[model samples]
Target: MRSFFMPFAIYVLGLAVFAQGTSEFMLSGLVPDVADDLHISIPAAGWLTSAYAVGMVLGAPLVAMLSIRWPRRRALLIFLLTFLLAHVLGAMTSSFEVLLGTRIVAALANAGFLAVGLAAASAMVGSQAKGRATSVLLSGVTLACIAGVPLGAVLSEFWGWRSAFWAVAIVSVPAVIAILCAVPASAVDPNAPTARHELRALRTPRLAVTLLLGALVNGATFCTFTYLAPLVTDVAALSTNWVPVALALFGIGSFVGVTIGGRFADTKPLQLLTIGAIALLGGWLLFALTAANPITALALVFVQGTLSFAVGSTLIAQALYAATDAPTLAGGFATAAFNVGAAVGPVLGGIAIDAGLGYRSPLLVSAALVALALVSYSVARNAAHRSNHSRGRSPESF
Candidate 1:
């Protein structure tokens, strides 16, 4: 019974993540519709994406600290409900200001749910399976990219952008019910680390570097991903009808990447990160150069997406592992780190475009960020080696 129920509970959590991740990413496809509907400039509309990310960055640690002592099921349910409410409000609001407010509220709810959900999923599995568990949760996000994001674009194209919000709200209902029925109260640790201990975990150099790596990798991803619609149609010279296809292909690659990362990350984290980052940088560079060719651009989009998520998911598992001493807040730290990248990436991409760098600028921006990520990894590897040497440990022990 425990075995049967555990996977069901984890997938339910993933379902909730699917709903939130849909909301988080669907905006990339709806940017023009949102701008036209709200009578805002395109860049201004793009800021909505940044706003959600910013809220996540602030909300993750805040919600984690506040719910440190609460029952895991209770925290998850409350956040899930708040997310539903925010979407409903967003769907009902025509005023951009109100919509922005809704996005922030929704993001707070998303951040809380993700932090709690990751902790809960990891706790349910054995130590050896933590990477697999993390992948299961993140798979929802990849699946969202595959189906929800493209469907949101289709819905927006046909029924209007608000329908996308309504769809997310509707999808979240089943997840709420599942959580209530399937999640056990014991998911929460009664003697969870104090908030101080959780914060102290951040001071570890290795953990800090891991978090930075997550930020850089995710930043590179969103920098390109957030502007994919424009890149497909404007730069690649594809029809608007190709936007969803491009997005779906990227999603497909992400799903594949996450699966591969999850399979090997437990035993070969450093190698996965190292190779994935290099390949991702090369993919981004190739994308920038060939973005004018529709076919090549589309193909590279898929390749870059795979490499991006492969590295991104591994970084997430690494962050959680490095912060093992602060089990309760481990997810929060990872959440905050990735969203920091999410927030900054698009903003920088937008700035580049605004400065007349062209639609391909985001691809170049992504490449640069990945390059920096590679350098950071080298620094981290050397530092790990020096520390391990002093302790008479193998470098691979890192």
Candidate 2:
């Protein structure tokens, strides 16, 4: 086995993957800027976010299952190249429709990139370091919240949303180069045994429940967060400049949440997920009630972002536990489901606002989704315990 500095590999891979992420999420804060520049409605601008996630949902597992036999490094390189080219296309395009179309293309690569990246990152270090490496990769996502998103928003304010795409284009190329240079080539065989094994893993009751929990939890979080900028600026009376800072603060919160949540995920991942969803419900409710005050509203927003994304590493950890026989496929599939949640959040929130439900209604709806997920988890847990008890006894003994 070749020796690799887990931290450096993580930093490089995470940054490369982070560029892909920021390309998707930075659009959330820049919606108004994008709308104004393209002469489109804000609802239309939101499709850019939805389109990217839709691509991820369609791409992640489809690629993962199909490429099961390919070398990991080669697959990643192909994905990264496409991811970079999509941004280049976005930067040069003038039509909002073309931009939206390009975003979906980018997501195809982005989802495959992340699914492969998670597998590669896990292989970087020793066994004990797997959770930490996953956390570090996900931390890239948290970093985008602090550094990438705010910077994108500021650039959009000055140079228009095109500048944001240009920034994404610039960073993506170098990251792609570094990834290609640094990552060692490795393959996971997709022969009948592995295929049959993963198919069996997918059929497991625990794995199904875990993916369900992920969709519900993620849908709950995004249902409010995708519209967070609009809620802060239009409904809460904050200046546009403040959107950057608020986003940065929210990123900081996510940093704390993920670090703390990462540790808990290893020990009792599913239990932690239920707890995280409860926190999400509380955060959304608080946001809905207090969004009228700028300072208080931003505080809740930061807390919401922090708590929700912090739960991510935990959720992935849960999926791995549930599908231990097929970590890569589970990771890819669960993440695609999470991407589906992202697609739903902005589109639903944007529609609610457009329909005159008011900005706060989205947060309220998020609260309800969280509440529903919480109940579902409780029932699942109870049923699991009962099943265990039933299995412990002999059927003929009675």
Candidate 3:
């Protein structure tokens, strides 16, 4: 019963994440349509995306704190319902302002759902399998990047942008039903950490660095990903049609990365991080230097995506492990940290481009970020080693 139910519940949570992540990422492809339909400029429509990121960053910790005492299943249900309603409202809205408001609301729901969902999924598995469980949950987001975003674009192209919103809301219905049936009432834990205790746990040095590492690594990925279209069409000299293909390839690589990396994350996290960071830095640098060559650019995009998520997923698991004392809020910390990177990466990349650094500049920016992440990892590892030695534990225990 435990075996059957655990995987089933985790997959159900992943399905919910798929629905939410589709809405989060599909906007990039639908932005032009959204602007035209609402009679807003493209730049204004782009704010819808930014608004979602802002909501996630602010809402994750806030909602996690507020719902700390709630049953995981109950909190998840509420968040999923809010998410569904936001999409419905968004689909019905004619005004850009109303649409923007709906995006924020949906994002808040997404943030809360993700935080709670991560905690729930992690709790379902043993310590050794936590990384694999995290990957399974996050695989939904990867699938969103691969299939959902493209499907949304196609739907918008045929039936209008609102149809995409409707599609998300529609698909989420099954997830809502599954949650009701699959998520056990036993998910509630009376011994769960209180908000104050969770807050104090955030002060842990290892956890702090882990969260920062997640942000840095994710920022690097997004900084390059955000500008992939320009890189493909302008720098690589590929046709505009090749953009989606490149994006899809990146998504595919990410899926592969997470699936493979998750297996080793719990047993060899430090090694995964060390190798992934170095490989990512080298990959990004090579991409920057060879982006004008179409074949090399496309290949490197896939490689970079693989390395990024391999490391990124492991960082998330590390955060959960490090925050073992704050089980309730660990997921929120991870969510907020990743979203912070999502918000900041593109801005810095845009700044570089505005300074005439060209399409390859973002790749360089990614490399630099990875370099910093590597330094952080080194410092953390050394500190952990010293602490372990002082406590008479073998360095291998770290």
Best by lDDT: 3
Q: Give a tens-digit lDDT track for model 2, residues 3-84.
A: 3345575677788767876887888778888888789999999888878877889988877776555687887788888888
List lDDT for all candidates, in order: 0.88, 0.75, 0.89
Compose the digit string of candidate 3's lDDT tens values, residues 1-398.
22323479889999989889899999988999999888999999999999999999999999889888899899999999999999999999998998999999999899999988888888878766778888888889999999888999999999999999999999899999999999877554677789999999878888889999999999999999999999999999999989988999999999988886777787888888888899999999999989999999888888888889999999888888888877658889899999999888998999999999998899999999999989988988899899999999877443
Off by over 4 Å in 1: 1-6, 29-47, 94-96, 187-190
Candidate 1 achieves a global lDDT of: 0.88
- How far out, in Å, is residue 146 in model 3? 0.3
How well does each candidate superpose onto the true structure, as a TM-score? 0.91, 0.85, 0.97
Off by over 4 Å in 3: 1-6, 394-398
Distance (Å) between predicted and true CA of 35, model 2?
A: 6.5
Per-residue C-alpha lDDT of model 1 across residues 90-124, encoded as one tens digit per residue: 99988999999999999999999999898888877
* Span of 10 residues, lowest total lDDT, candidate 2: 389-398
Please tell me which model should have the higher lDDT, number 1 or number 3: 3
Residue 94 of model 2 has an lDDT of 83
Pairs with backbone N, CA or C atoms under 3 Å apart (clashes), candidate 2: none
Q: Which candidate model has the greater lDDT, 1 or 2?
A: 1
